[model samples]
Target: MKRGVVLLGAALLLGGMGQAQTGSAGSKVPLATGTGGAVATVDLDASRAAMRILEAGGNAVDAAVAAAATLGVTEPFSCGIGGGGFMVIYLAKENRVVTIDHRETAPASFTPTVFIENGQPIPFDQRVTSGLSAGVPGTVRGWQEALSRYGTLSLRRVLTPAIVTARYGFVVDQNFRNQVQENEARFRAFTSTASLYLPNGQPPAVGRRINNPDLARTYETIARQGAAGFYTGEIAQAIAATVNNPPVAEGTTLNVRRGNMTLADLANYEARLRPPVVSTYRGYTIYGMQPPSSGGLTIAEALNIMEGYDLSAMSEPEAYQKYLEASRLAFADRGAYMADPEYTDVPRNGLLSREFAAERRALIGSQAAPGSVPPGDPFKFQTDPSYPLRPAPAGFEGNDTTHLTVSDRDGNIVAYTFTIESIGGNGMVVPGHGFLLNNELTDFDPVAPHPNVPEAGKRPRSSMSPTIVFREGKPVMALGSPGGSTIITTVLQTLFDVIDRKRTLAEAFTVPRFSQRNAATTGVDLGGENTPLAQGLAGLGYRWAPTPEIGRLTAIQFNPDGTVTAAAEPRRAGGGSALVQSGR
Candidate 1:
């Protein structure tokens, strides 16, 4: 933990060099809007609607909930009310932070064997698809809870933008069309799905104006009736009726598979607020969503391991070597120890302890190995009883959602990330819902006894890292990203860029990104690790990642001068935004 400060100083020293700065590849700053010393950024126009609520005097909670609802329409492929996620909030009035774990839970009827095939385990791909894989959705429930507690806006008011977008029409973009085209085959597999998506038996071309009148109507119902309208109201009944028929209609969808889904599942679902996992490195505090999520622990472990080295003076290659070594070690701990705390007794504290971190740091060598093995730790056997085991066939590799950062002059901030699993999710669309259902259930480990095995109502482990940093009891940064597991790494690196390297928010985000999966024993897979500096690090103990695995990141910095400067990952169309109080 002591290394945090040192790393910062090192970054600052290096940043002061005459190295020329480069623009990010696919990152952009998000559009920001607010007033009275507050600012917010979201991925789409509707998200801005949520920010408008704050501008109109709503609090952080209200703005976040509004932003979430708006995303259901504008960023449907990334997130919607049908999905589940986590929320990290910094409450200015209370001077405290709370993490809402509205993450999806396994249904009671869920069982590990559901994914097995012909008396044997099924492949990860098959498990990632199909109806049996769906968990109880918490996206809407979670946001609603946030609104209830911290927002000042009404649900109807907050949801208005989503309603308007769905009712009329929104122009399709290249990314939108691309997502549809990519999933065309699977989308055609379900009749109802085909009716909604394949109106011409093909994806709409980019720039085409597409409309979902049904989804608009549904949104209106939801706004008027609250979450009840979507879960137990006519919308739920319509979904049930449609699900009873898998065939598609000429102009609508009936492709939902028949199954055990009942109104009870929707009505019974509720998002819970869980304590966040908190740790301090040097003088900075890092907080993340708890288990059923790997972000906090994995990030902490990586940082802990890195703390053991003096990476500042090392050349790029040397620094890269040490970074990769630390990541590898932490990933090993993540694979062996990380899981849903509700399902297993994860060693949350010990893993973050200074003594444990120091011991783990001692194991890294200056030479990098071609391939990696799980780092050994003697503490596992001595501390707690391990959870039941499942033979995880080499864990499969993968993938983002979208992120939003919000803050007010009062010091309240919210760092949030949302997703619909893969690009188009399950490719199942409810008539009039104007969005896709999340395949989030697929995030659960398909193997039995893995602690993350499917159970009705059990939330799967997620890589989403929505974080807020505090300094001397004041909120300093509210940031998060869209990369699956890579989200944590991108976020951590950005934190280093900000706190240590002294880079501006935009400059920090422009730095190239890299990542490793949830599994242990593998080096990071970099999407853009081919830089001269990164290449240099490959010579050190760090083995650079291969091509195409980096994740996108977006962040907003609340500077000491009261100005907010934001930056979005250049790898995507998204851009970051900032705001300042007029007097400042």
Candidate 2:
């Protein structure tokens, strides 16, 4: 380990010696280093907490769990135990990659028309805050499973920093304050929420110290009693009650509908270990979360399509066009076929097959397609003639999520993306838990008899693309981002930047992002809109819309010489990346 650390440091120094200056702001962001490990997350305190775990002799999984726990306290609006996520781990010793599905599942009492009223859907605002939006959270169980299966430390030990931060307090930053203030009306709907977030009748001022002893107690119970503590006992009861009988402010008449989740649903929730969606792109193997998550398959399909084009030789505008076309095709399939495989018969094999990609690739031309593209018949390539080809359904997407990437000296890596589904999720906090519950159930379509319709115990499809890349049978990169449906395109763009354009990890993250997603107007960042890439697409009959933000990517890259580089998206405030040398 010590020797590996030395070689890694030397490689980083050499890699940084004389690189050409890029105009991207991320180029100016200093990279953090550690001899024993490295961590990149959206919160500085969370990164430091994870680094402390590595320094204490924990491995990559342990540090990841630690950072995840801390993020719950620090970035509560984005993620917490009340939510669920996916984790992709690269086990260095075993030379294998593993993925864990901790995605929240609909309650057993749910039905296809749960969100439908009369013959139409309920109002978006009411549904967003109502108990009907909560799912059986899977985050706590996921953390426990990862730790027990691959970690070097106990849950009690790994959760210490988060527990301390929640009990004592952490300073609120401008970003956090702004989020709170923006959602003040929603927070005001619940007494428990307002008490914790809007203390003294307003959102905590920037840099103000905030504490949540109740949340600390909840973590304490989990530490002492394991996953059961959160899923089956007092905490579980609180969660159920909050969802089934939500508290409304006086005279507010929320008219919110109750959810069907019971204690039994919470108790029965189990995180699964699933096989990752694997595909090869330019000699590198990409692994991502499978069904219940459209990220892996969509990314793989996009890359396969672009592989036929010489992206490196093409002008910026040409490359962007190819990317937009690929995204359109993949998202069309996402709406048609992507869903929870346990409940739906998704043509997984056909979707990731190169031949299937070729069939779809033939649809793209020098000109952009008009309006939203329709999904293709990939199932036609399936060997199973008896397989059911269900009709695909369109569903809403969410963007409030967080991601963390970590790599230890031992070579193990973790790429995890978790979320509460929306900002201040459901606007309901478990009475004393000091955390927000996810609206993941809304990810399902309100229509009946569709692939993505709500169903008993079915996991909602997600676009959180927790991913890992390998070269020549060895792990090389762990990457992911948070941006709802945009996640797939964001990751696809960055991968192309690094692999085809030969940009550093920072440059790849800093580049302006763009996405089409089968929509009539392509969404581009401010910079992308002003570039020739936009004008060229417009000349090809494409309409463009400017997006304020696209993704918050956290990525770590491992060089052949043993050195590792990690970075958090520069676009997000409070983002952090740090590395610990092997001999630390």
Candidate 3:
């Protein structure tokens, strides 16, 4: 690893560009309630930045974009311009919900067998550190489109907070340090990555300031030149070079494969505008992103199944069992049907239909599936319900992503989830651009004859479920999270908690979680292995292992008393931040 890095020089270089931000470095609040506006995120700086935007008269979309950009700096390992995500927006004035699908797209050179050779797939972990794992990023384009379409501020105006955060920097905390330590070996393989993240050949000390003037300059260019600065000129070329021919250390032992990305792919990228899927459960209408993301469909189907039962009438443990069973049933269909809409004909209507959910619900008996259940048949589609599933070729997705929720005084709301697909993605930073590349392409299935297999310019299916709930034509809640696939279950369970069990938002988030994603054994992040719930579930044919943690969720609720409440994970991601424009 490199030694004696000078992160301090960045502070000196950017000192004259603008005044550094104040009152955000130590702004950590896990829950806040008030009126006018609200913001919740997994980072102090990010949440504070959004709150500042709201205070400046920006709308929810503008504040959300501001928060997203700041997360690219403070939560660098999880997200940045190198990645892409889905944004769900509720426009109260228009009385409708719209979604932006900026999910990453594979290069034109990609093919179904890109990850396969000689009838075998590349080792998942080996591919994670290579150039072959990145996709054409869509975040910058997504941000530009959002601002042009619905935002009240310019890109330059909204990006000021992120630019300042990058220039002046934020203090490194334990979570940030722990993430670096976990990726140290891979980070050391690339000179550019190691030089910035691994100061003194180790994770930067907790409470130490780390600045990135290069990133600040990059943001400035995009601010001044709009998306063109990122997609058509120097920045785009740098990204392509970094992905096609990685900048590894001189004597590295890693076998990083070259990628297929090019300038054309970057220039041609578009953040497609999609209509949000609408589903109702217990009299509330839920809005979520459409296909190219299974989150909406899976969660809607699970909620439909859940609606079939009186979860409110059951004991806590009984409700947990039904939730697990519903999760498994939903994941079965997800594994079998969910994929990029452009390439795969996803059964949108059938998947979300109450009839389909009822059919699938019947298969869930008094006991869980003996091992794993197969996908059930949906209406208007002819297929055998018992078709054998292809065994998984590789498991490579990381539970690494960041979610932010924002709502303004006028009632506009946004729930955004973006990610680089893994912590310290690709473990290689663009030489001077000062950002990590995403391993998002690793989310694609490795083989052919599968809905999720890679295809030229095809966006990989994502599990990001940014959701907003509306009751009587007005938004009641907005929420999302950053676990890989467990994201679906996380959002589902929380929705059930508040709507069915009458739990407070804070109580819903604090409770232990049991995520069953159609797996033979449910992953238990519910406190511990020896918990009473765990012991009691064993008798019902349930098997589980400890997952340590599940997901860090951020949510905002529009209350009946004309006030708003923002809540974040109190114990996840070193505790999250929830800040309102004014205190209650």
lDDT of each: 0.63, 0.83, 0.85
Instruction: Determine which window of 10 residues in candidate 2 has minimal summed lDDT.
Output: 16-25
Instruction: Let me know the TM-score candidate 1 reaches against the reference structure.
Output: 0.86
Q: What is the lDDT of residue 409 in candidate 2?
A: 78
Candidate 1 residue-wise lDDT, 59-154, digit = tens: 767767766766676667678866778899988787778988877666566677766668776565554445554556687777778887877777
Ten-residue region with minimum lDDT total, candidate 3: 1-10
lDDT of 3: 0.85
Instruction: For each candidate, give its TM-score against the true structure.
Output: 0.86, 0.93, 0.94
Per-candidate clash tally: 33, 10, 0
Task: Using lDDT, give the best candidate's number.
Answer: 3
Q: Write the per-residue lDDT of candidate 2 for residues 356-401, one digit (tens) a residue.
A: 8998899999888887887888887777653655566556777789
Ranking by lDDT: 3, 2, 1
True-structure Cα RMSD, model 3: 4.9
Candidate 3 regions exceeding 4 Å error are 1-27, 379-396
For candidate 2, the per-residue lDDT at 406 reads 90
Q: Using alpha carbons, what is the TM-score of model 2? A: 0.93
